[model samples]
Target chain A: MSEPTADLLVVEDDADVRASLERGLRLSGFAVRSAQDGPGALRAVHERVPDAVVLDLGLPGMDGVAVVSALRAMDHDVPVCVLSARDTVDDRVVGLEAGADDYVVKPFALAELVARLRALLRRGARAAPATTPELGEVLAVGPLRVDLARRTVHVGERAVDLTKREYELLVVLARNADVVLTRERLLELVWGYDFATDTNVVDVFVGYVRRKLEADGTPRLVHTVRGVGFVLREGG
Target chain B: MRRSPSDSTGAVPLSACSPARSMSLRLRVAVASALSATVVVVLAGVLASVLLAREQTERLDRSLVPGSPAVLGSFASTRADLAVTLRGPTGTVRRVSGPELPLSPVGIPTSVTVDGVDYRIRTAPGPTPGSLVTVGATEDDTRARVAERQRLVAGVGVAAVALAAGLGWLLAGRAVRPMRRLTEQAATLDDTTSAVRADGSRESEELADALSAMLARLHAEQERSTASLHAARDFAAAARHELRTPLTAMRTDLEVLRAHPDLPERDAVLDDVLRAQGRVEATLTALGQLAAGDLPDAGGGEPVGVADLLRLAAEDARRAHPELAVVVEEPGADVPESVRAALEGLRMALANAVVNAVRHGRAGSVVLGAHRGADGGVVLTVDDDGAGLPAGEREAVLGRFVRGSTAGGPGSGLGLALVAQQAARHGGGVRLEEAPGGGLRVSLALGPDRAG
Candidate 1:
């Protein structure tokens, strides 16, 4: 695949790390603009709309999560890939929840980060392509159903009051029913942020979904990959 | 302490502090043995005393009572005979051969009593009724003698019993003495350092077995934990190896771009790339060092001059944080020659300390001193003027990745922790103390240790 000519905005607090990432990304052929902090990143975004963002979670001024949230509030949909030195599983989950498209744990292999960036960009490109099934603003699947437009859900024939969070979580799952969605990807799509709050909100909410679904034997789903992460499967 | 046997033995309370099972078992055995023997001896002595008194009384009574009838039968004899004579309903005669007989009681009987020289007499039918004769004297004296013998026997028996109880106690204490010593030794032992095996006699064989079993379990746990630690280090090393290549390439590229000034985007791109590469490389470096230090200062460095180490360390700190006060306390600074290099390592560790003190610790008197401890090893103390690391995190800050909030710059945060590791490797340790003027004081102790 050819590198995109559109520029990529890289936001990080550490000058040395920000510089290295831009150099590598540019070498891979993506045009890169660098920002040392959140204000700089947001300013850069306004100055020129980039194809994607490479954001660091531990920014000095406005954190990466706040920056993503602000951009989302402004109705921007540029794909984001979070880069941070905190490699913990919860950290990855937190970053994704803040609207990041993908994340790389620090001390991460550069190759892995590059691969992650490519995957996220590929997803964005496919979503825009007319040939790919354009998932409607609302979709429902089996007994586990979602209304993306209303941002709500229903289990079987019962109207379950889903939280804004739960509704968004269900929409992501419904959009890719029967497809295994990594916990990071799920968090990114639902939470619209790129950092974890150290809360087991992911596992907790998954348990909630399972509990609600099993209230009347509505079939089981949401399988976990032990050491990896969570994946939502269909019945059985 | 009491001057008595009681006060002389503080070991009593110390023994009481021993494990409850063995102590209780010993006490139970003592009580049971004493009780069983006491009951047997007391019952047998009482029965024997009663039977012996009865036998002696019977001998005196039989002779005295029979003679009464004989004396009565002789009542018709001559007055000069001085013997009493009497005739019963049949042709019976009663006579007492002795002259000292007291007047008997009025009740019918074949009996006589003698008090000193006086005599008393009485007659009674024998098994054949009035056909019996009675004669007796000195019966009163005889009964008094019999009573005296009985008293003597009872007194002797009481004394014997007291002796037996004392003897039994002595035997029980003597038998349990070795066991008490075994218990005392067991309680004082620090199993964390060296192995301890139970050594007790056959009587205390059970106690020894229990101790040995527990020690064996302790040894097994220590071994398992050591093995697990090695496995973790290996795993970390492997991870570092796998993550190093791309990080190297990224770093190289950034360094390359920095050398070229013509490209407009080169500098910007190089800055971000280098930053990323640095994080990756720093992580790898930290990981590798942590794994390598998994086995701390195995025996390395001899007694290097403490003064030399301190001076070298001060120079380093001067370069790192020249603004901070780095003063050496030369009083009683006798650093052993064997720990010279170890002290140098200490200085490196302390340079980090000085920098941190300069950074986070208040800029106060940073005293670095070296001296010999009471245990015959050199001790070095580094005092910083910064607010002391919290007591809770004093030990924790020495762990990998954890650092004080005062870590403002992009530091590796491995400095203090590495110092701890180095000290540990050298069969020594580092401690967190409150400095004289209220700041963080880290004392490093190093002696001899084998390399891991």
Candidate 2:
């Protein structure tokens, strides 16, 4: 009855699952559009970019990972949450590596998926206006640097490319240099996920940032403190 | 008396019970040779001593019976070790030289001890008539010589025994080198090593061959079990993945219903939930059938008539789908009356094919037919005038949990997979081809060996 909070796209190969998700998301206060495969999902996005996308990893053609890669290639910063039927760490990692913002295993609680999507959309909203800050602030830790106004990163002389989630995670770590940030704190600061969940999206994004930062064999700027969390400092 | 338990528990007693078992083969061989050598040498030494003593006594006896008494008396005086005793025929000592001699029997030499001295004495016919001469010699000389020689022989015997033990040990070590090498090889045996070889004695070679054979068999058995375990694990993972999709839909539908109690189209939402539930149940049943088919055949095959099979399948399809028409085509003349096959399994496979055509293909009619295959086998076909799959997807749809792109409605993707499984079980295959009248045709072939 009320205006929808956001526009969401549901891409799943299973028609029953896709229909159920479309209806549930619509009832949960989002204008939901559904697609049955990866290419259909991309066509829908081309027609009108949604606020967030819930994509199944096991699509009939192109697959969810390929779709995410294509979306990232076109510089579409829309938030994406993957739905994976396989409960393997490798499968989830592969999706995240392909630029998925988050993931939930199949047969998941609708409430959980809804919560994750909301967090992703909120983060996307906050990141949109980050390029027009009043003052151009630069956060530097050792050789790694983040340009807040321009929304870009460089490690020494080399320009480091990063996805939206990876950039956000690195910016959070660089802003609080030399300070140990727990996994829960990082998830809140970077992913906008306030509630407790078992997702490892924070660690995955941090891995991406670290790999891009250390691409030229630069000494690691982000160090993992065993059993605690991570810290960005000049020396390990 | 009762033996103490401690006696049995001691290490010494345990080793002593079967010393040969604990001893090395080389050491055992050496000890046996040493014992035999000692026995032979000691026996030869004793015999030589006895013969030498007798020969010395006979020489002394011949001197005692000289050709005349004059020579006898002179002979006795020349040798101090020889004491000549002249005894009368009445057996009384008449004359004596050196130590006194005891009178002894005539013509026989004997050992006598006199004044704590050993002597060899002999009595024979004297030179004078009715006179007997007895020669008494101190056997101390002969005894001493024999004793000395015996000591020398004993020393030689001991040396021989030591030499025999040393030689035996060295030879036995050489003889068992192959066995020792074999033992070392066996100790290092692992999964990567395929065979063990010991090229020496025939017995060692035979042992190595047996060991290698046993290891190869174990490796094959292990590989087979590992492969089957992997197959079962993959099947379980796929089943879980298939079941989750429907379950996800059902859960979402239920949550929506519970969230909006009075929303319009509530019945339709409830129907969706029921349909999803039914899909889950059907998927589970199909998965169970697939798992059962994976197991080795359990003597289920029987002689089944080809015509009878097609008729039964068409009847079952008609009964299951009352709205659709089912037709059974007559078998060709070349086709046999009976084929060896698991009747129940074939029936199940055909039923799945029919279900696939009706549910996914949306067929109006299905024709069941049979004919003799080109490979001397029987081929059963199901032709449907429904929406058929594209040529590219027909082959991919045969795999487990794979559904064709054109699949419509809600059905488990395991129907054609079941048909494929039965085809493989019957030593044949399944093929999907375009039907004669712009429909889909599924051909299930049974191997030539199954034809009767």
Candidate 1, B125-187: lDDT as tens digits: 454555433334434564576567666755666666566656656676767766776666676
lDDT of 2 by residue, B1-452 (tens): 33356646643443324423467889988998898888898888788778877776676556544445567678878987777767676867777777777767767777888888777777778877778776777766666777887788888889999999999999988888888888778767788989999888898889999999999999999999999899878877888888889999989888888888987978988888998999999988888888788887767478999998998898899899999899889998998889999887899999999999999999999999998899989999999999988999999999988888889888778999999999999989999998875789999999989999
Q: What is the interface RMSD of candidate 1, in Å?
A: 6.4
lDDT of candidate 1?
0.61
- Considering every candidate listed, which one attains the maximal DockQ? 2
Q: Could you tell me the lDDT of residue B107 within candidate 2?
A: 78
Q: Candidate 1, which segments miss by more than 4 Å at Cα?
A: A1-3, A129-138, A141-145, A148-236, B1-410, B413-452
Overall lDDT per candidate, in order of appearance: 0.61, 0.85
Error of 1 at A115 (Å): 3.0
DockQ each candidate and list the results.
0.21, 0.73
Report the CAPRI category for model 1: incorrect
TM-score of chain B of each: 0.40, 0.79
**Model 1 clash tally?**
86
How large an RMSD does model 2 have? 5.4
